[model samples]
Target: MTEGRKMRFAMVCSSNQNRSMEAHTLLKRHGLDVASYGTGAHVKLPGPSLHEPNVYEFGTPYKTMYEELRRKDPDLYKRNGILPMLKRNLAVKNAPQRWQDNAADGIFDVVMTFEERVFDMVIEDMNNREQKLMKAVLIINLEVKDNHEEAAAGAKVALELCKELEATDSWEDTIDDIVAKFEREQERRILYSISFY
Candidate 1:
């Protein structure tokens, strides 16, 4: 929370593929220390269908998933850009790890989630580990649409909020406003199309 010290951040999503990874990649590139995780039991992504999604488990190496995907449907996998996303997932080494797995003291100064479910999961996990988890860590949820374009936009908003958090001396006053702004951004996005693709 102090301006002089580096703020550690953790971004969580359902699959750790789209949203959180986008935020994680950009935040790290901009010199913020960040890590990403997922609250899902397994990694599930849009693929053929709900019955046959790209399902992977935590601790399952990204390379394994990529190979499996390539073997299952090479053409479709290539068409959907899953290969690059897999590579990025592998680079980060975070696969749908449950929030409970990320629990630790002083591990994160700020924990941000891309969805309400994940935010609840993190809080529930933290509550269960009240003795071990850091009490001072700030948890914020910013709803992010699950798509490459939206994830990129969400990442920028996250970066802006992170910088603002660093500059502020009091979080109690600005925290609610920050969350409201994030919600407003989501609403404004729902009625518009910024995509060129």
Candidate 2:
């Protein structure tokens, strides 16, 4: 077992299809308490053309999307890596979850977003929530590209950050030093703020 109390984490992105799922799988594999979320109104994936994208509601099953995409154009989706991505996502969770819809979700110790806009959305959503518990959560943003390769790399960094946070007994007391050390070692600037749950 780990030394300190396990910190609950949330990985968030625009659609929760690629970046957030990538990080979620990695964190879960390492035995971390974690969940993934999207800030968008719909879960979106690339289509045969840029103008035409496949969009599904927040709770749409990944298996359903996989079957539909494969049936529609197996070769195209396979070539574009969407099939492989869907397979990974299916292994991690049942469906794409929207951040706004999950307000009732119990408090998370950390909420990490993959983009600036998404970071803004998460912060806004948290601010709008009715803070009954008054527990503090650190919301951090580490910009990651939506593509698979970048998502994988970003997930590794996220994993490292989570590890550091997990090692601490009280994150609220040492978060400043922890984030500073991370930014120095990883050579990546991070934007972060503390909000209440």
* Candidate with the greatest TM-score versus the true structure: 2
lDDT of 2 by residue, 1-197 (tens): 24768899999999746999999999999999999999998988999898999999999999999999999999999998999999999999899999998876777999999999999999999999888899999999998989989999999999999988898888888888988989999999999999997
lDDT of 2: 0.92
**Candidate 1 regions off by >4 Å?**
1-4, 94-96, 104-106, 132-134, 169-197
TM-score of 2: 0.97
Once model 1 is optimally superposed onto the true structure by TM-score, how far is the C-alpha of residue 24 displaced, in angstroms? 0.7
Which residue pairs in candidate 1 collide?
none
lDDT of 1 by residue, 105-139 (tens): 24677788877887787777766664543236677
Instruction: Report the error of model 2 at residue 121, Å.
Output: 0.4
lDDT of each: 0.71, 0.92
